[model samples]
Structure formats: C-alpha cells, structure tokens
Target chain A: MKVMTLNFLTCAVKNCKSSNDSFPLHPKEAELAKDDIEINPQLLINVLPRIDWAALRTTSTELGFPTLPEQPPSPEDLQSDEALLKELHELLMETQMMEGKLVCGHCGHEYAVKNGVANFLLPSHLV
Target chain B: MLPTPDTSHVPYNRVYEPAEDSFLLLDTLSSPSETAFLSSRFCSTSPSSPSPPNFGAPLVLEVGPGSGVVIAFLTAHASTIFGTPHVLTTAIDVSPFACAATNLTVRKAVSEAEAEAEAENPSTSGQWTSAIQGDLVSPLRPGSVDVLVFNPPYVPTPGLPAPPPAPLQELRDKTTFEEDSHLLELTYAGGKDGMETTDRLIDALPGVLSERGVAYILLCAQNKPEDVKGRIRSMGTGTGEGEGWKAETVGTSGKQAGWEKLQIVRVWR
Candidate 1:
C-alpha cells in the first residue's frame, strides 16, 4: 500500500466510522520499499486539496519519515519548491508499505499487511 | 478505441474472469458521452491552465475488481477517458487473490501504456493507490470516494456464500479445488434476486461517495435495472441537501428481443 492510501482508509468496524482516531490507521512494523518513480509536480499539486494533511502528517511520522509541517504546504508553495515537492512525492508516491500491520486507534484492531496487500476483513466477532 | 488492459496473468480459478459484463463497462466508460461527463466532472475546466485552485484529483475506486480488467483500463487510459492523468485509482475485494491479481493487472496496464507513450509524445497515466482486501466499501473513509465502479455478483442464486474467513485468507499455499470453487462463487452468486449484495452497495453509496461522486454499476436483466434506478433516484446524496440522487442507463449489451440483457447505470447527485 502506498503511504497516500492511508489517508483515505479507516477502521472497517462500523462504530469506528464516527471516531476521530480511526481516520489514519497507524502503521506498525512497516516494511517500506521505495520505487524510482519520476515526480509529477502537477499531480502532486492537484492531489493536495483532496489529501487530509493532518492524517498524512500522522502517517508520515508513524512510518518514521521526518515530521511534516503543522500545516500542509499551499499549491503555490509546492509548485515553486522542488525539494518539498520531491519529499512529498517520495512519501506519497514512491514509498510503498510492503509489509506491516495497520492498527486502528479506536478499536485497536490490527489489519495485517503482507506482500503489500492489507487485509481489512475483520474476524467474525469484529464484523 | 482505447486498448483494453491485459488480464492474461490473472488466475481464473479464484478470480472472476473478464466477461461480457466487464467488456460493457470498458465500452461504456470510454464511450463519447460518458467520457464527456467524466471529463467535465473531474478534469480541469481550462485544459491549458496549469493547476486550477481547489481542483483536486478525483479518486476512482473499483469494488470487487476481480481480474482487474475494468479498473486497469480506466487507470491506463485515464487521460483519454477522463481527459486528465491526475486521477487516483484503487480497488477493494473480499478475496485476497482478486486483490493481488488487481495489483498486477493495474501495474501491467500502466507500464505498457507508459512504454507506448515513451515512444511518442509524453503521456501520464493515473496513479494506482493500492488494492485492499475488504467487503464492498466497508474499509473506505466516508465521503472520500469520487468515482466508484462495481461489477458485482448480480447472478441470482439460492443463497450468498459467506466470505472467506481471515485464516483462510492468510493461507499462502495452493488452495484446494473446493476452496477455489468457493472463492469463485463469491464473485457471481448474488442471493435473493441478485440484489442481496448490490443493495448493500447501493445503501453505502450515499455515505461512501463525495458530493461530486458518481458510480457506474452493472446490472443484468434479472436484477430489474429500472426498479434499481428508481430506488437510487429516491435516496438522498447523504448531504441532507440538494436534489435527490440521479440514475440513468448509460450502456447496454446482449439485447434479446427488445430486452436488455445487461446494462450499466450511472448514479450521481
């Protein structure tokens, strides 16, 4: 799973939908792999508005990337700053979570990730 | 016509093979009218403009992308279909094999498209986020999805098979024939008029989709396409405001004596 995917994922448990802690499932024992993808500044800029910056910051820190700024950079800021654009690209596009467990903060349910695919199927009891 | 994504590598034993229904989706999405609708909804208003303010890239989610031919086609030919490459794609399936197969299918299509583009003018394909194993749209954040596609288990059957247990899903070794059969059943057997699964997905649409979200769902004759559209039209967009949902038949195939065998319904606010 790409780091960017975490921003749109939440605890599959029905009750967790309304919980604030469930927005960004925390990565634990994550194995990261970096792909040599050419950066596309336009894509990054366009995707910025849809991204939940606060959740991304949490995911970035959990994955051991350097702490991101308190606020997401503006589209204009990203367009002119090559280094910042590359950093965002590396975290969101190039970096892949090959193996790990995504633990939902509210229910503490651990969704296992093996071979880059995260299993979000809850057990019978949880479901 | 845009090239269809290659799904030759996908194992048909457990994954749903690309069939008439899948081909219909490809044809429908890339059709001129649907392309115009998608581009207008997702693409930047001014093509020449660099980056329009608040114009976020649309996220395309495919529920149960069995062999992944449909989603792969959308991702690979995004610029041609959606008129922009700034689109994000992902998939969710109950079967782990389908999820794995989807990842491979999307990657192969994107790379092939990239290679072809390299020889000519530069072209950018949409980004594929990831394929997660889950039931329907249960794992997605509410109001996050922009464009949702589903090729569901629309074939009427006696009863719906239960999804694979977590332990079974974890098995990495070769599956037994019975196990494979069961996995394949999850792709087509839709208990109770084939609306058992599609109904749940329809209910989730209001919650799973964004304000600008749209969905293209495939339904067969047995599923009562008009009634389904009526049900969708009556529901709210989950925003508690604006007009009720809208649904219309955008594509059809396998006509039999004036009866539409299978149809694709586009649902939106």
Candidate 2:
C-alpha cells in the first residue's frame, strides 16, 4: 500500500470507529520499497488539502523517514518549493509498504500486510 | 467510447469477470449527463485552465472491484469522465485474489494510458492508490470517501457463504476446485432478495461518505430498484443540508417488455 493510503484507513473494529487513536494505523516491522515514479507536482498539490497532515507525520516517522514539518505547507509554499514538493511526492506517492503489520491503537489488532496487500478481515471472534 | 481496461490477465476462477453489469457502469459513468454531474461536483476550474483545482482531489473508492475493470476505467479516463486528471482512486475487496488482480489491472491501464498520452497529448489519468483486502467499507475512515462505486453480490441465493478466515486470505500456491468455487461465490450470491449485501453497503453510506460524497450502485430487476431508490431518498446524509438525500436512476440496460433488467442508481446528498 502507498504510504498515503494509511491516512484514510482506520481500525476495522466497529467500536474503534469513535476512538481518536484508531486511525493512521501504526506500522510495525514494515518492509518498504521505493518506486522511481516521475513526480507530478500538480497531482501532489491537488492531494495536499485532503491529506491529514498529522497522521501523515506519524506514518512517516514510524516508517523511519525524516521528521516532517509540524504543519503541512500551504499550496503556494509547496508549489514554489521544489525540494519540499519532491519530498512529499516521494513519501506519499513513491513509498510503498511492501510487508508489515498495521496495528490499531484502540483494539491492538494487527492487520498483516503481505506482498503489498493489507488484510483487514478480522477473525470471526472480533467481527 | 473509452477503451475498456484490459482484464484479460485476471483469473476468472476466483475473480468476478466483467459482464453486462460492468459494461453498463462504464457507459453510465462516461455518459454526458453523468459526466456533467461529476465534473461540476469535482472540478473547481474550467477544463481549459491548466491550474489545479482549489479543492483537494476527490477520492474515488470502488468497493469490490473484482477484476478492477471499473476502477481502472475511471482512473485511466478521469479527465474525460470527471473533467480533471487530479483524482485519487482505490479499491477494497474481501478476496485477496481480487485485491492482487485489481492492483495489476489498474497499474496496467494507467501505464498504457500514459504511453498513449505521450504520443497523442498530455496524460490525463488519475492517481491509483492501492487495492486492500477488507469487507465492504469497514476499513475506511468515516466521512473520507468522496465518490464510491459498488457492483455488489446482487444475485439472490439461499444464503451467503462464510468469508474465509484471515489465515486463509493469503494466496496459496494451489487451490482445489471447491475452494475456487467458494471464492467465486463471494463475488455474487447475495443471501436474501439480493439486497443482503447491498443493504449493508447502503447503511454505511451515511457514515462513510464525505459531505460532498456520491455513490453509483448497480442493481438488477430482482433487487426492486424503485424501492431501493425510495429508501435512499428518505435516509439522511447527516450533512443537515435540509434537502435530505437524493437518488435517481441515471442508466439502464437490458430492457425487455417494458421491464428493466438492470439499472445504475446515483445517490447523493
């Protein structure tokens, strides 16, 4: 899964839906891969507004990347700063979690990721 | 008409094949009226302008994108269909096989479209996220989805099969015929009135969708399309827009003796 996808995912457990910590499932033992995609600056800027900057910061730190700015850069700032744009593009678009476990903070459930696909199907007991 | 994404590589034994229902979705989404609606809702600027929209890119999620044909088509032709290339696409499915197949299908379609664009014009395809294995919309964050598409298990059957255990979700080196059949059954075989699965998806709409969210769901004659639309209209989007919800039949096909065999319903706030 692309690193950006983590921002939109939460714990599958229904009860965790209302919890603040359930989202941006933490990555553990994550095997990462970087694909050399041609950066599309406009696409990155388009996606910036929708991104949960705080969650992205947590994910990037968990995945061992350098710490991101405390606040997301404004669209105009991102547009003018080529280095910042490329950094965001690399983390959001190019980095892939090839293998790992996404742990929900609320339920402490570990959703396993193998071969780039994360399995979110809970066991019958949990479901 | 846009070229259908190549799903020839998808294994039909486990994944749902692109059928008339799938084709109807392609036709409906790309239709002039639907295109106008999508573009107006998603695009912030005129197409002639080169600047990105003021709003964030609309995230398009396809629930149960079996062979990924539908999502691939939407991703590959985002500009043509939604009037903007700045769209984000993803998929969720219960079957791991389907997830793997979708990833390949979307990638192939995007690359092929990119190649064609290089020779003809600038690329207009949207960005494809990843296809994850999950049940319905259970794994998604609430109020995050902007455009949702579903081609559900609308075939009425005695009962829905039990989903495979998590341990069994990984791809095995080989599978018995019975296992393959069971996996395929998950793609169809709605438990009761063919609405068993669709109903669950409908209930999630109000909670999963963003305020500007819209959904395109396919249903057959047996599913009682009129009643379904009525129920959707009555439901609240929680946006407090005071208009409640709106459901309309935007596309239909396989008409016989004044009876519509299958139709696509567009539901929105």
Candidate 3:
C-alpha cells in the first residue's frame, strides 16, 4: 500500500465508529520498497487538501522517510515548490509498505500488509 | 474509450476477464450523451485549459472491477478528456487476485494516458488508482464517495457460498497460485436471483453515496431490473437520500430475443 492510500483508510471494525485516531494506521515493522513509478506532481497538489498532514508526517518519519515539513505547504506553495512536491511524491507514491502491521489507534487491531497488499479484514466477532 | 486488457499474461488467467456485461457497462458510460454528461459533471472547463482550478475531482469507487477494465477505461478517459485535476479511482474486490490484477491494469492505463499527455505538453501531470480487497464498500467511509460503480456477480449461483475465512488466515493458507485461482471463480457466483450481492449494495447506497453522488450498476434480466429500480426508489430518506433516488436505464446490450440482456442502471438523488 502507498502512504497516500493509507492516509484515507481507517480501522474497519464495525464497532469502531469514532473518526478519531482510527485513521493513519500506525505502521509497525515496516519494510519499504521503491516502486520506481513516475511521480505526478499535479495529482499530489490536488490531493493535498484532503490529506491529514500531521498523520502523514508521523507515519513517514516512522517509515524512515522524514521528508514532510512540520507544517504542510500552502496550496500555492505546494504547486510552486518543485522540491516539496517531489518529496511528497516520493513519500506517497514511490515508497511502498511491503510488509508491516497497521495498528488501529482506537481498537488496537492490527491490519497486516503482506506482499504489498494491505488486508483490511476484521474478524467475524469484530464485524 | 473502453479499456480492454491484453490478457495473455498469467495473472489475468486467475481474474474473471471482461465479457459481454463488461462491454455493456463500458458502452453505457462512454455513450456520447453520457460522456457529455460526465464531462460536465467532472470538468468545469474544456480539456485544453491549464490545471483547471480547484475542480476537486470526484472520488470514484468501483466494486468488483474484475480485471479493472472499466475503472481504468473511465480513469483514462475521465482524466484525459476532462483535463481533470485528478482521478481518485478505487477498485474493490473480494478476491485477492482481482485486486492485484486491477492495480496492474489501472497502473498500465494511467501510465499510458500520462505518457500521451506528456508527449502533447511536456509539463503534464497524471492520475492515481488503488485496488482494494474488501467485501462491498465495508472499508470505505460513509457519505464520502462521489461516483460509485459496481459490476457485481449478477450471475445467480445455487446458493451464497460461505463467506471466505478470515483474511489473514486465508492468506496464510493460499500458498499456491492454483488455490488463489479457485477463489476468482466466485466472482460471478451471485446467489439467488443473482441479486444477493447487488441487492446489499443497493440497500447500502443511501449511506454510501455523497449528497450529490451518483451510482452506475450493471443489472441483468436475472436481477429483475424493474423491481430493483422500485427498491432503490423507495430506500428511505435523509443523508445520501434526496427526494428518493432517480433511476434511469442508461444503456442495454445483448440479444433482445433471449434472457441475456444486460442493463446499466444509473442511480442519483
């Protein structure tokens, strides 16, 4: 899973309804891989408003790519700053979570990412 | 253009390759009138303009994008023709193989589109596509999806096979590629009236769609299109529901003489 996708995914437990820390599932024991895909700067700028800047920064730092600034660039700055856009692109698209555990902040449930696919399935009891 | 995968690859053998129903879905979405409607819906200006300002591209999710043909086709065209700022496309399927295949297919389509755009204008950017493994829309947020699409397993099965085992344990057991291929066969195993899965998504539509969101679902004769439309039109009120959903038969395909007819039902509130 790419960091951009992880940003939108929340814990899937049926009972975990509060939109609190359920999102930006903390990646534990993450193994990263460079996908070598071309970066799309305009796409990055478009999604900037929807992303949670703080959560992304925390996750990126944990994954050993601390490229995001403490404060997200303004929309205008994001478009104009080529370096910043490239960094965000590298973090969001190129870096892949090959193997890891995404632990939900609210329920403490772990969603495993194996072979580059994050299985967001919950147990029947939880469902 | 309706995207068709070069299915000579090994991984594609495990996926439910596109068929008549798939083409019908494509025809519905790409028809001149529908294309015009979508161009207007997704783009505020013509495609030649530079970075169409803040045209917040709608979030499009496709359920059971078996080979990702339809989603990728939509992404390629939607981004290219509308000059959309982004095509935030997501594809979901219960089978792991389907998810992988979808991601691959979408990546190829988006890359090709981006390459063409770059050749035309040296400074063009691109789009993003993600294929997820989940049942229905369970993993997605409610009332957030803007363009929901589903080409469900509408071919009726004898009965609903037991839902797959826990994902992690099942993943652990799928040590062989052949074992994984077996699951792909269930892509068309829709239980009872072939509406089992389709019906559930219809029931969930009111909660799944954004206020102005729209859904395009492919239904066949086996699914009882008329009755399904009635059910959708009466799915209660509030939130995603706005004066009840308006259903229209956007397009249909297959022999009129037989029961092979497929219809694309466009639902909006």
Candidate 4:
C-alpha cells in the first residue's frame, strides 16, 4: 500500500522485488512437490518422456516420493486402473506452479517462487 | 475515478432479499467519457485486424459484469436486432453475490426481450448470458470467444468502507485488491492518481483476444490519451508487431448520458 509508480510493462522484471507484484502467476516444479501431493509411483513412467526424466528421478527420490522404477512401470503394470490419469490431473492440470522453484539445467540457478508465482528470469551472466 | 450512483450496499444486503435487487443504480464515473470512447474505438473497428474465421459461432465474453447492465443492453438489443447466436457471455467477477445478481439480471432481461422478439417472429434464436466467479487474469478458453467487453472498477475513491460482517449488509466501498497499487495511489495516498489498478486491468488484454477476436479495454483519460494507450501499446503487443493492437479516443463522457466526467480511452486487438 505504500508506493512505487513504475509501469509494469516498462519494468516488470525489475519489479520482482514488490510483494504486490508477480510477473506471471504460476508456481514452479520444485516448489510444487513441497505440497502434500499423494505420490503414485507409476506416474513416473508415463510422464518420463515429456519432462526432464533424469531430473524427475533425482528430485522425486530426494523429495522422498518413492524411488522411480529402474525402468518405468510397464503398460501392463499400469493397466490395473486409470490411476495415472487421475494422478496426472491433480499434478499437471489442477496444481498451480506459482510458487515452485525450477533449477535451470543450463545455468544451475534456482529461481524463487512466491505467491503461486515462479520467477524464471536468469541473471545476465547465464546467457 | 467514477462518481457512482448508489451501491446500495449490495455486498452487505446479499443474503435474503438479495444484495443487488430492486434498485435502479447509476454509477458516476469520472472516466466514462474514456470508457465510452474506448468502447467505440474498438467496437467501431477498421478492417486491418484479421476478421473472425466464422463470425457467428464465436461466443462473446464480458468480465466484471456488475449489475449486468451492459450485457443486458447488448443482449436485449442483439436479440431484437441480429437474432444471431454470436454472443455467449461469461461474466467473471470474484463476488458470488455479484455473479448471482448478474445471472438474475440476465435472466429477467433475456426473458422479457426474447418474449418481445417471439411476438414479432417467434423463431428468433437468442443466446443467454452466464455468470461465473473469476478474476481478470484467469484463463479464458484459448479460442472460443471472439469479443471481450469490460467495465472495470473505475471508482476513484474506495466507494464504501468495509461493512461490519453480515450477509445482507449494504455496499458502500468499491475498492478491490488492497494489494493493488492503483487502489492505494488514487485515494488514500493523497490525490487523483489511482489509475494503476485500472491500468493493470487494461494491461492484461492481449493474450485474452481470439486470433481475430477483439478486446475492448475501457479506461479514463483523466491523464493523457496517448499516455494511457502508450501503456497498453508498450505491453509486448506493439501496434506493428506480429498482429497489431490499436487505441483510439472516441465519444465523450458526461452527466447528460448519466455518466461521470471521465475520458474514455479505447484499446483493441
């Protein structure tokens, strides 16, 4: 409520310091895992091709979501039910990536996410 | 800032008899001239923006549709005039009570207007309005809508103080998002400078437009026409980018048209 009249279009990246501002309202990957996500180990297999799978395995294991399968659970292994669909809906579609941290593979920088928002702006030195 | 008519404590009187019911309200906007101008600038669009692929099928969207006034006017007129199912409104406002009021207003209006149309042709295909609880930046279906209409909270002052807790209290204040920089600067911060929220309200328009759909942003030119349009143009959607965006200052706002004295700055995509 105090002040700063900077135009966001003009200085949005610079104004990341404002508690009242968020450049984009999406949490990041690491921060989302901090929430109470009920882990379904089989999901690792299906989503592996789409994301950084190696990062998924490491991060999931580090976060104490059960270790992902050495080889993803097979299609036959996943056939017991549509559990993967339900689980993915919660993790991918429903969840907000607003406050999550994403570690850059390129820069090794950790972006701070706040208010359900993740800042992906890397320092100039990264480029 | 807008000089609004009776808020009638809609937020407070929301339980039993209804908060927005039984009142013919008029809001005195210091920015209506700007709003009307903005509305015209875009509504009277020129041919350069890509025309909708199929014009009649795309639904129209209205955000923060308080009291459902504009929708009522547009729908009632369209039902009588076009008889085309081109508009399907999604009135997004955070207040559940406001959503209810809008739903009721739309129902009553469409019922009456549709009835009149039936008397004439009896086969008019009129589309109804739907209200939903949402904020401005929330996701809109990527390609379903072709028109965007908005009459954001242009109140210069906090219209009323927060009512003591009760479901049916009256609304005296009109400020939203205490964290919004615009609400603070114009009123409590000292003088007539509370345009940040209104400006930010305009800033989030480019992405919401259909590939060829138009976004009609209503803003006041209490400051400068070019400055307000420049704010919108600066948003990555420059007038000469991949697809251009433009702003024009049309129509005047005045007490004669039951509007407060605000200049209307219109921006389009």
Instruction: Please report the candidate that would top TM-score against the real structure.
Output: 1
List lDDT for all candidates, in order: 0.91, 0.91, 0.73, 0.40
lDDT of 3 by residue, A1-127 (tens): 6767776676777666466778668899988887786676656766775566888887888788755788988768977988888888888778877788888888999887777777775667887
Per-model TM values vs. the true structure: 0.97, 0.96, 0.85, 0.46
DockQ of each: 0.87, 0.86, 0.43, 0.03
Q: What share of the true interface contacts does each candidate keep?
A: 0.88, 0.89, 0.27, 0.00
Give a tens-digit lDDT track for model 1, residues B142-251: 99999999999999899999889755686356988988999999999989889899999999999999888999999989898889999999996566878889999999
Q: Candidate 3 docking category?
A: acceptable
lDDT of 1 by residue, A22-122 (tens): 87999999999999998888789889999999999998888888888899998789988888888899999999999989999999999999989999998
Q: Give per-residue CA lDDT, model 2, range A1-127, as digits (tens).
A: 8988999999999999999989889999999999898888878878998999999999988998888899999878998998888889999999999998999999899999999999999888898
Q: Which residue pairs show collisions in model 3? A: none
Worst lDDT 10-window in candidate 3 chain A: A41-50
| Superposed model 3: Cα runs more than 4 Å off | A37-41, A67-72, B1-3, B10-13, B45-55, B80-85, B114-118, B121-126, B166-185, B240-243
Off by over 4 Å in 1: B47-53, B257-260
Which tens-of-lDDT digit does each residue in B1-269 have in candidate 3? 54454434425445687889888877777788776766677666455875565535567788888788888777766644334646577777776667777777777766666666775653232345467677788776666577888898888778875555664233342445655545664677789999998988988788778776789999989889999999888777665534877888898887574666889999988
User: Candidate 2, which segments miss by more than 4 Å at Cα?
Assistant: B47-53, B257-260
Give the Å shift of residue B260 in candidate 3: 2.6
Report the TM-score for the A-chain of model 1: 0.97
lDDT of 4 by residue, A1-127 (tens): 0000000111123333232223222223544322333343333332332233343344445434455555544445655536654443344323433344544332234545443322232334331
